[model samples]
Target: MRVLVCDDEPLARDRMRRMLERIPATLCVGEAENGQELLERVPSVYPDIILLDIRMPGMDGLQAASRLSESDSPPAIIFCTAYDEHAIAAFKVNAVDYLLKPVRQEDLEKALSKAGRVNKAQMLAVRRETGVAQPEQANAKEREYISVRSRKGIDLIAVADVRYFLADQKYVTVRHSQGETLLDETLKELETEFGDRFLRVHRNALVALSYIEALEHKGNQFYLRIQGVEERLAVSRRHASSVKKLLQSL
Candidate 1:
């Protein structure tokens, strides 16, 4: 597992780095002087876990942790603080564990052992505590691909390639860059998971916002013109107003 050490004090970071070396299974991938540095390095380092210090110069560990938690994929946090008074607050921020500073080797080892490598499921559970539903939280990241079975084998369809999903009786037709394919998932589930990129136009259809060309109102009916695909999808009267609002925002 890749671990990131974050502390303003050079000596504190050195001690933690040395202790981490003793555990050959884990690698100290990066180190940051303060919370600001930690945020800057996080995207590049992509550490599995971060050992964060509570009090920092530009930004505090708690503030940094909050911002990190909002990320599509946030690393697990283990806060190291000198003040015991911050223990309750640490847990409130969904930290894996809090170690009192001058952190002890035993405590550090214990915390590391608790969460060897946090997965999306673990992160979803933590996000649930903050009132986001576990199901939606699990897919906070715009899913890069959709797995669909083809005549040859399974195809990994890029989400960006998909123009729209039109539901049939039991299956959904995925109209994409190459053509169309069948998907087993429901339109409602796809609407919730990819809400940022997709907009539900009808009861059975969800179209990609990026591919939307224009909205037309003809003979008291509304239709959506999509990019690449010449076929226009009907927009239900119930959803036409909401779709217009979304399109206007873009």
Candidate 2:
């Protein structure tokens, strides 16, 4: 499997590279210092798997994984981070697996094994939980669309055309190429259902990584611009590093 290893620390990157050499199906296709480098190399390398770190200098791994999910096809994402607090969020993002820092060879092997079973849709669900059932279901006919409950009735939206989802108190606004629709679900509920395709940019907002145009930083604050949208979304201070890293990767 072609693999991309991303981390800010040189020693950490080297250690991951060395450990990967022991795996038979794995190949170190590239190494990135931050999320930005990963994004730039993704189109050309087309790695099968990515070993991503949660923290970095510019862009962090979580943001990078979010951006990668926007591509026509995305690789399996395995978060390799030091913090346990991110585990819940990582699973919400549909990461194939989460590996704590100082990744063990056995754990890496297990992750790779999991990656091998995953397909593109599964990878997409892992990124945003857009309703894909499993890694193998990516190729199944039943997995291509999502049903949204609205005042009109049950509407099915093709998963690919969805741009983003906005949370407004108890309601969720589903934004797509055609327009927007309101659903009676919380952001947290949507996170459970479509976690593969949506990422929480803020506490209330879950956005489609593909629709993100750019990220701007002013002092310690950060905001995201979405394609065809005039509004700039604010990212929390806690998620700032991850957002920047994701933009760099894009």
lDDT of 2 by residue, 139-196 (tens): 2233456678766878888755566778887777877778887767677765665555
Query: Which candidate has the top score in lDDT?
Result: 1
Q: How much is the lDDT of residue 204 in candidate 2?
A: 77
Off by over 4 Å in 2: 120-250
Off by over 4 Å in 1: 120-250
- Give TM per candidate: 0.49, 0.48
Q: What is the TM-score (0 to 1) of candidate 2?
A: 0.48
Candidate 2, residue 69: Cα displacement in angstroms equals 1.5
